[model samples]
Target: MGKIVGSAIVSHHPGLMQCEDFRRMMGAGQDSDLIAGYERLRHKIEAVKPDVVVIFDSHWFTTGYHLVDGGAHYEGVYTSDEMPWYLYGVPYNYRGHPAFALDIEAVSKEMGGYNRAIAHSGLERQYATLNLIKHLRFELSDTPVVSASSCQNCRPEHFLQSGAVIGEAIRRSDLNVVLLASGALSHRFVDIDWKPNHPRIFHESNLSSPENLASDKKAIALMQDGRHDRILEDWDSDFRKAHWEAFGAHYLQMLGAMGGAECRAKGEPLSAYENARGTGNIHVWFDA
Candidate 1:
């Protein structure tokens, strides 16, 4: 039976797409740890040698159904509409695991969950998935990738159900998979006018508010301790109030795949927790 060999919660903020010199300049002479964290994450992934990487793309927001990119292959130049200037004209070419995606759909149906696998060549690509591909240098390897979208209309429980479907599908298949939750912690962005006043945009002090910073830190601590149960328990009362990226579905889905509240996978920090325009970003690897 196939199984999840590993998983991670990674940052896909547009700032990471910039050159090292520019990134350092913005960070007051320090490069975003996410830059070096990619290399470290690459080593972790290589050690497991997964056949496919399933990305829970927080940026790819679908309306009613959970969509899976089932294309046989993808190749083209991508430019982010959200931040075109920072992430423009990026070339990407990668194989897709259509069979595995189809399996996820089948399992979803059995579980009465909403899921669809689309192989349309015209489907758009988001930076959440592409950025990781570029940074991890997936082009240098043969591992195929498939991206799953967050259903914007769903609540936390729905995302967890989708993840359970995916987990069951993976277990039924023969592909060793790595799950990547591509999103941020507290996702409140700074107002446009605040940039001039907060020049140190990458620093923790610049996070949206003290509450957001504390919420992110608490969540991170819980993750490190393998206490996802507490995080989920406080989702509505605490973490949700801080407004996690993509409503935090990226993380909930990934956790669901790993056994949800029952999961006790310890997370190791691959990069220091940092700020991205008031949002909480980090690279954390969860041992499977």
Candidate 2:
């Protein structure tokens, strides 16, 4: 089998490529800053130059657990640019142009059995898989790529199961595997009120104010004080209470991918920022 190696995690926040602070973090270059975080990540990937690249994003799917084998020939459901979903919803465009879309409903139906992590609703297995396709279509446009074959009906017991699927794919293919898990750390929507004992409210809000660079500093202080674990366990309700679910699916996905059976959790925050809207965008990664 080809060497099973090289993994990465890239933030999908539109602000990542747009913000000056983020660029500064990236410019840190191998020392004393968040960019060095990615430098270590790159070295890990280089050590295992995987050929079969599997990029998984927690935000992609809508319903069920899904997987897209990039090497397979599969039919995808397309939603046009004129579709209502794009008008008032989060519009995903690639390279300055609109793109074809896939339906998560199909994938969810294809993959039976679901998990209800949150009390009200959560991403179904099918939706997650379909979202991956849409994300890949937009992120990797302008390339000659085969369509993705959807994987359904698998309820991952834990994050390890997710990695096992990728590992199995690598064992089956002639190419080395590059696994990408995309998600953020402690960010929440504008409406989310983390309700820390002493809330250090920054100017206006962190979501929409691009000028408010100090909020991230506050977040770091909160983190340094060892308040992050509470955020992790209570994030589902506390963070989601603000109007959106903290996308921890990617965290779980990465755990499942990297750990498999012998996986233990070791984590670090790579980058953190709040948009003009006060929504926090923090990139975190874990190792097993």
Candidate 3:
């Protein structure tokens, strides 16, 4: 079966978006660096060295719990003058589930408890998942990296079943190294008022006002306490305000796969990339 190899994460502020180069090289340029953040993301992905990568984007989801069947097959995205990255056999696809099915109780059970687990796991309430497809390389012999699709949204209990499904996929792959989760700490910013359906990228001055101390402190406290409800509330409130790039469900699922163990953030916080947006791009590592 495949095993997690390594993982890399950075704040996805449109300003700091880092994977554009890879995307462009692969002919996925419909994307815009309207935010410089994409460029940095590519470096992060490269560092992970994943044969196949699963990305959980919060921007695309229904209100209820939902998981995209990443292993499902699809025709390669080729047309006109474009050649398929893999013109012969099968194309790569994503397989991890999103975090909608995971709730506070389920999270607690997975981690032990709010206080004990948070202190032990060193997890910030904010996080995301990036399971490496290479981990499932063995399974590839039976089920090559063909593509398919479906979305499922269920309760926490049902979510566990979903996790089992994903885990099974990994175990079958027979991969050596599996890239795990990576994401930010929180998203409250000073003077950043916002709304939904707003642009993903924006100007810096509109976001960098220094009035977000209260919210930030509150978030830190909730995280320290392992209060998922409060953490969710504060995050959603602030998220609506600045409305910059974010991937909450993505980070949460990554942390879930880590067995809720103690994790220490490894890098400096990069908060000024996308219009002075604050993201938990802090690098982290943990023991299994």
RMSD of candidate 3 to true structure, Å: 12.2
How many clashes in each structure? Answer: 0, 35, 57
| Top-down lDDT ranking | 1, 2, 3
Ten consecutive residues with minimal summed lDDT in candidate 1?
193-202
lDDT of 1 by residue, 1-288 (tens): 999999999999999999989998998788888899999999999999999999999999999899999998999999989988778999999999999999999999988999889998788899999999999878779679999999999999999999999999999998899999999999998888776335555778889889999999999999999999999999999999999999999999999999999999999999988888889999999978
Q: Give per-model TM-scores.
A: 0.98, 0.45, 0.41
Model 3, 91-137: lDDT tens digits are 33333222211232253345443211011122111112211232233
Candidate with best TM-score: 1
Q: In candidate 2, how many Å is residue 194 off?
A: 14
Q: Lowest summed lDDT over 10 consecutive residues: which window, candidate 3? A: 115-124
Worst 10 residues of 2 by lDDT: 96-105
Q: Candidate 2, 41: how far from true, in Å?
A: 4.9
Runs of candidate 1 exceeding 4 Å displacement: 195-200
